[model samples]
Target: MNTKQMIKENNRLQDAMKPDNLSYYQDMVVYIRSSSVEESKGEELLLEIAQHLLDAQAKGKTAEEVFGSDPESYCKELVEQLPKMKGLNRLQYHLMIPWIALTWFFFVQALVGFITTWTGGPVERMTQVRISTLVLIAGGSYVLIHALMRWMKNDTFQPDEARRKINVRSMGIYMAITVLILIAGVWLGRLLPVLTIAPWVSLVLFLVGIAGTKFLFSSK
Candidate 1:
């Protein structure tokens, strides 16, 4: 089965597990799927593990007893054994989020320009952004994502309630940091060398970004 098929099957099988068992198993699932391992391989391993867990459940075995206490370590071991995404594939994987954000940023600017022209207001055909602002936004995004992934890895072994709390707290922190990044970018943009981009250019870039992103992320 493909990754999507395995995911659906895994979900159906997981629904039959006891709440505690499902929670425990899900941590491993999240950690493995989020790592740099190949997608199909990761989902295949998860489906296999899910099936094993269900079989164990029939014998009244808990997830912890079946998979041991250190699920994170087990997942780490499996990730090591799995084939890692490399070269252009790895580049595409990592750049997917940032590319989408940049694409939408251009799209919004282009839309605003068009709207201004249509409304008979001052023709705003140009958008200016500073080099320093671009650097900070990209660097900050990478750091934030890296930190969040680390948090996910570390939180995998915690209890269900604790995991939920961690996730909520992490999300809050992530949003707060994002706001700070945007504010800093705005401040730096005012002080740095500005590059003016035309609406037509932005529209072209938005189109290219969309096509590139679709190519990079499309399921094979």
Candidate 2:
């Protein structure tokens, strides 16, 4: 199928994404020379790709062999050989991913902080001994989680125009409550090294919160 067809296919996929995530994918499609339709070309184009896949399958080609085992590895290989340009290029953009990831790290940490304060706690631990440890562990864990999440997103392999992105949805009360709990968990997790949020106190709170969360989420 043509690029127009591919982008339409992509937009349908984007609808499932969070707004920012949808915008990112839409921009990716536009940047990649695939954006060409207001309405989706997803179904038609997907049919074409599917037909091709079917043909390949009939010939016993492995999915990995057909789709490529890893686009990231392929992208890396391309960058290795792609000449250093006078100005920015795709390779340079790939480097920006690390910074983008760092941005996400800080953003998530900030979110955790917000989650804590909103749920009646602080994101940063109350003491210095935990401070460096929090920074190191949270920073490292952030990177690992970010990579894992991104990989999962990539593996979903929806086109840049995918229509149904996840994020910023109005699960409303339940999500709010869960995020509150998450914020508290994150805050307490920060204190794990120091054995803070003492067992007796936490045990009672945990049971109560668990009951609350279950009830809220189960609510219509």
RMSD values for the candidates in order, in angstroms, are 3.5, 17.2
In the predicted model 1, the residue pairs found to clash are none
Residue 56 CA error for candidate 2 (Å)?
10
* Candidate 1, lDDT over the whole model: 0.82
lDDT values of the candidates?
Answer: 0.82, 0.42
The model with the greatest lDDT is 1
lDDT of 1 by residue, 26-49 (tens): 889879877898888888899889
For model 2, the superposed segments whose C-alpha errors exceed 4 Å read 1-87, 123-220
Off by over 4 Å in 1: 159-192
Give the count of colliding residue pairs in each prediction.
Answer: 0, 25
After the best TM-score superposition of candidate 1, give how far the Cα of residue 130 lies from its true spot, in angstroms. Answer: 3.2
RMSD of 1: 3.5
lDDT of 2 by residue, 1-220 (tens): 5545554554555554445434433333332222122122323433343454446656866445554755345433433442343333333323333433433444444455456657877434621133333444444444444444444444344454542342222234335645654575578666665424332333354455445444432212
